[model samples]
Target: MNQQQFEKMKHGQGFIAALDQSGGSTPKALAAYGVPEDSYSGEDEMFDLVHKMRTRIITSPAFNSDQIIGAILFEQTMDREIEGKYTADYLADQGIVPFLKVDKGLADQTDGVQLMKPIDNLDETLRRANERNIFGTKMRSVIHEPNESGIKEVVKQQFEIGKQIIAAGLVPIIEPEVNIHSEGKEKAEEILKEEIRKHLDQLSEDENVMLKLTIPTEANTYKQLIDHPRVVRVVALSGGYDRDKANSLLKENDGLIASFSRALADDLNANQSDKEFNTALQNAVDSIHNASVNKK
Candidate 1:
């Protein structure tokens, strides 16, 4: 889709999920999950597999085919190949839109979120991708402030960050969450929803309304977050490295989430244990599909 088309997505309710494929996630398995093998863990050997998975998604009547596959092109090893395919001609040849995710994640001064800090190298990365004719992009900025000041800080920082991006012609996914738990986790999700809405509304004025968002299932159910009119989309990010819980959450939400992914993908990317990771991912997909069918 074009930039204008993407901007119009704000009117489309329900969340867009970032399909989770991390931690020893094999291309063969991702193929089974409906993502092209070439799309992740890049290998010419699995090009056919990737093609098959994508084709299935496109043809699947049960699943939303506009589904996004996250972290596919983010790997440094895969950039060279993917960027080549992002060119205008390459786009025409492929006949598919790639939603690039850019996020300058949180910094706790230590720990996992902090360690990944100065995240998503958004500016320079998108510049290169845009030059490669890679147009549509999504930036997921995770801010760690759990109180009002943190909320305000996230709004200001994300706005400044987003203004720079929209000017350069890329979409930003404004994701400011209180990690898995924060001072407010004990409060209610409305606090999180309200905080997110404020950020999004403020960011909405940044150049255009093209900024897409990923609202966690935790936040929603914790406070019945989906009730917000401003929350145009929902995203279920895998949590605590548990597939059963992740799948259970997916079923609980009734396909409201359009995307799903987690740190497991990081583990997969780094060549970590793929056994438990793959099993969890499969359960999530199965649960989501079952939930979609029976509304369970």
Candidate 2:
């Protein structure tokens, strides 16, 4: 691991930018960016358009290290270049750390949750990410209700993959998101916390990891996890919440910072002028940054 990047990740005061929309989510992401479904006929064209969108966002003055500590990227984006430099290298140049989304998306729901699909060639992926100066990886799983066995299984899979990532010398953002609209949301969070604590306790003193969770039903639900010796940081996923609501809930939790996707891109439109785009992005960044570091 790069010590400088590690120090920045451990101490940085801003949120991470989630720009890792994969094949499953790319169409939705692009449509929201004002590109209709008919705009592209195939996967290649779709990816090209999304890459352009990502490039525009990355190159924008509003997207910078001052308010963004890191960015999580898709595999395609990681392999692509920005202004004659690799995506991760460009982020590093701007003083922002880069991470890759390492999972192969979610498997079919079972046991009230959806775990990650088996990742093929994970070792090769991690090797490539490391070679590109990437500092970490993010993978996601989802829980719909408080099924103890299901939640336990989700966390278990996450840690197992996380250990693999760690062994490859990269931090893993272990994310087991409880569905924001789950009928038994609070109870689910409780079970999720217990499972996470068990794993954190098992980690060696020298091992460090990050957690990405949904904003809990109650404030400070992950307080112990936030302060855990093995946890480097704990970030919150927007999880379908609008920007205002997500930030509002985030303020109620003291240590967690944002790693928003849709919320971050909420007001941005493909047709907006550069000035308008930057203004909108700056407003979102400021609000999220305030909620992150200037707790209510």
Candidate 3:
């Protein structure tokens, strides 16, 4: 592990940017940026376009470690380059830590939750990520209701994979997201917290991990996790919230910081000139930064 990057993540006063839109979510992400489905001919062109979008964001003057400590990237982005350097290397050069999203995607919903599909060649992927200078990895699971067994399975799978990532000398961001609009959202969060605590307690003193959760129904819902000896940081996903609302909710949570994807790209448009795009991105970065570091 890079000690400098680890320290920055452990105590950095900024938010992480989630730029890791995988195959299923790529079209939606591109459409929001003003690229319609018809604009691309096939998967190749689609990924190429999304890569351009990411390159633009990374290269913009508005993005830097000052207010953005790290970025989570799709596997394709990790394999590609920005300005002739591998994506992770480029992020490091700009003082931003880079992380790769390693999960294939969600599995079919069962037991009121969707666990991550089994990741094939995970060790190989970890090796490649390490070779490219990535600092960590992020994987996601989803919960639709407060079913104890289901949520337990989600967390278990996460930590199991997390250990693999750790053995490879990288930290893992274990994300088990509760659907924001679920009928028993608060109840689900309550169960989720307890399950996470059990796993955190089992960690060896030298081992550490990060958490990326949905913005809870109540403020400080994950305070214990945030302060856990084994937890390096706790970040919140926007979970379909708009930027303004996401920032508002994040402000009420004292230690949690943002790891927003759609919210960060909400105001940006592909047709905008560089000046316009930069200004929009700057505003988004500023608002998220304040919400992350200036908690109410």
Tell me the whole-model lDDT of each prediction, alpha carbons only: 0.43, 0.95, 0.96
**Per-residue lDDT of 144-208 in model 1, one digit per residue for the tens?**
43455555555566556756767777555444444544444433234545655565555443344
- Clash pairs, candidate 2, are none
What would you estimate as the lDDT of candidate 2? 0.95
For model 1 the local lDDT of residue 61 reads 31
Per-residue CA lDDT of candidate 2, range 1-296, in tens?
98888888888999999999999999999999999989889999999999999998999999989989999999999999999999999999999999999999899999999999999999999999999889999999999989999999999999999999999999999999989999999999999999999999999987889999999999999999999989989999999999999999999998899999999998998999999999999999999988898887
* Candidate 1: 10-residue stretch with minimal lDDT: 263-272
User: How far out, in Å, is residue 230 in model 1?
Assistant: 7.4
The clash count for each model shown is 18, 0, 0
Please tell me which model should have the higher lDDT, number 2 or number 3: 3
Candidate 1, superposed: residue stretches over 4 Å from native:
1-72, 75-78, 82-96, 109-122, 133-145, 181-183, 186-188, 203-232, 262-286, 289-296
The model with the greatest lDDT is 3
lDDT of 3 by residue, 47-164 (tens): 9999999999999999988999999999999999999999999999988999999999999999999999999999999999999999999999999999999999999999999999
